[model samples]
Target: YHLAREKKGMSLRPPYRQPHHLASAISLIGGGTYPKPGEISLAHRGVLFLDELGEFSRKTLDMLRQPMESGEVTISRVKQTVTYPSSFTLIAATNPCPCGYYGSRERYCTCTPRQVTDYQLKVSGPILDRLDFVLSLKSSGLQEKAASETSAEIRHRIGCVRSLQHERYGSHSLNATVSYQQLERTAGFSEVQLQRIGIVCFEQKWSNRTQVKLLRLARTIADLQGSETMTDSAIQEAIEWRKLPNVLQGGEHLGPT
Candidate 1:
């Protein structure tokens, strides 16, 4: 924070931690007789990758709920309580099912309907609700016909948006971290817009927290284009995040935009 505030260049080293198969709840969520920081804390202000996401133990994965929502993980030990920052951009990859062939165009899924259902249940509904965006991607193994934009190019664009947000908020407060009243006022949601959101919440059975998340996503969408006021299209784009087939299958598939 000091380096950034002073306009000095901090090294671009973001932590990337992956706790794959055989990873325990204690390892992922941080817990022991003597509490210690876990993968989430290591990945703070960075990315945490969960590979073979569906194969993870349900109970262990569920432990992510609190930290994913609050940006901090608390481990209560016999002697003390340890709290660690876990504000991370979570990235997960996995097959559509346990057999690793559920949606594959080439391989047929051998798992039965009930098996697929049970396998996906490892990621619960509440966990799915906590995710910001979801994308249903087709399998692609072939080389790209066109060259895609590099990560550096994307980062430069995101940096411009971050600068705008910093200027507006007078700090590094993200759209996700801003208070509701500030969001409503700064984003300038009109009565009609408010009604649209309300109707979505009702139709989708979204909780108040989910409603706030949608608002934040809308704010970020507008911010990406340097728009002071959130637009209807931004809200619609945010709404589509939850409607993806991956989300419908109870997977938290949010990735950095």
Candidate 2:
């Protein structure tokens, strides 16, 4: 029984696991009388998408922090100890509030301020800090437009960018995973841009981790534009993209300086 799992293993062609919001800690993190791999491990070298992110228990979510940072999860039992690779890309989606209509122009929010605060706080600060960027999206009706770049063309452009990054930081390195010092040395931020970032960070009271993430995002934006050096527009765009609404503590708006 379960022979296919035992022999062939759970690696799909680019494995993608979307665990339900009701998934238990044991199911997601892999723990039982006899321990085995979990969704994070099953998604190795692939993706772990958490939809309706706020619906998961905070404890279950926090359990992801260690494995996410270490790229592996260790389970120790009386009979055996197991380590599983968990190097999967994490993509989570959540609503702006409990009723999911907060800030919507077409619909009025049904949630009270306290309820909204509680819902937003489900995803804790540590998780937010670890995230590279947070984007808030609003639904819009589709309209006719001119032809844009095809998927093939976009892929080719991305491939070229990857090659450029590889040349800069060896075969295995990309802007997201590179060390701070290495990136900073060649990030190409001018003196004025650096000073502006410093001032903004101070004003916003951003954590050291957040500041570094901003730089990494800016660096990638520059790379995407085929720019050898970071530009003011790139830095500003990164700032806007990375701006986290102050929802954790119940703020009604985001004044992303």
Candidate 3:
């Protein structure tokens, strides 16, 4: 409804919802005797929520890469090729491990190292890299409760930040949604900062795509803070977010972004 209002007169981009039970590349790609359209294609200009993300077949999940990267899904038959829009926000969730207690402090992991590896391996590196944000949630006990901002307060702040982004980009979207060229112009990083990022990328064997993603995330952090400049701290925070999965796998430090 919001998108329709925003894009008046434009074709309605119907949101696609594919349950976890329909976990198959064929299902996603519309494979059958008379193959139809796919979920990714159907989810154009909307959201694709994949619950129990790790349980999805590796091949099925792998099929997401092309559409995610290219923003279109192509289905080829004997006679013709059909293309569909796939510009959608991909949201997913999964357990930390097979036992769902890999990093839990209150509970012990019942799964073996092999089991953990197998589970992690289900979500491929390429797919993981495509994700813009990777957040880890740990259960907080009641004793840890303290005075914190409410959802309304958080939403208000978000609205302010979004307004700032709109003024900056001349659009009602975020830096994350901006193109690489736009990013290069608006979120330009300093030589020193780029050098620092280069050092980490080289050491960690991070791909160029990941490096750009880190910069984009850092830009968003800066925008949220109402900062005209992307400070070193903001860049560091973005880098840390990108490094979180590694930290979960036993890497140390994992300092502030």
Best by TM-score: 1
* Sliding window of 10 residues with minimal summed lDDT for model 1: 1-10
Residue 76 of model 3: what lDDT? 80
lDDT for residue 246 in candidate 3, whole number 0-100: 67
In model 1, pairs of residues that clash are none
TM-scores for every predicted model? 0.87, 0.85, 0.81
| Segments of candidate 3 deviating more than 4 angstroms | 1-18, 31-35, 142-147, 171-173, 249-257
Better of 1 and 2 by lDDT: 2
Residue-level error in angstroms, candidate 1, position 64: 0.8
Off by over 4 Å in 1: 1-12, 141-143, 245-257
Angstrom error at residue 43, model 2: 1.9
Q: Model 2, residue 35: displacement in angstroms?
A: 2.0
Error of 2 at 186 (Å): 2.8
TM-score of 2: 0.85
Best by lDDT: 2
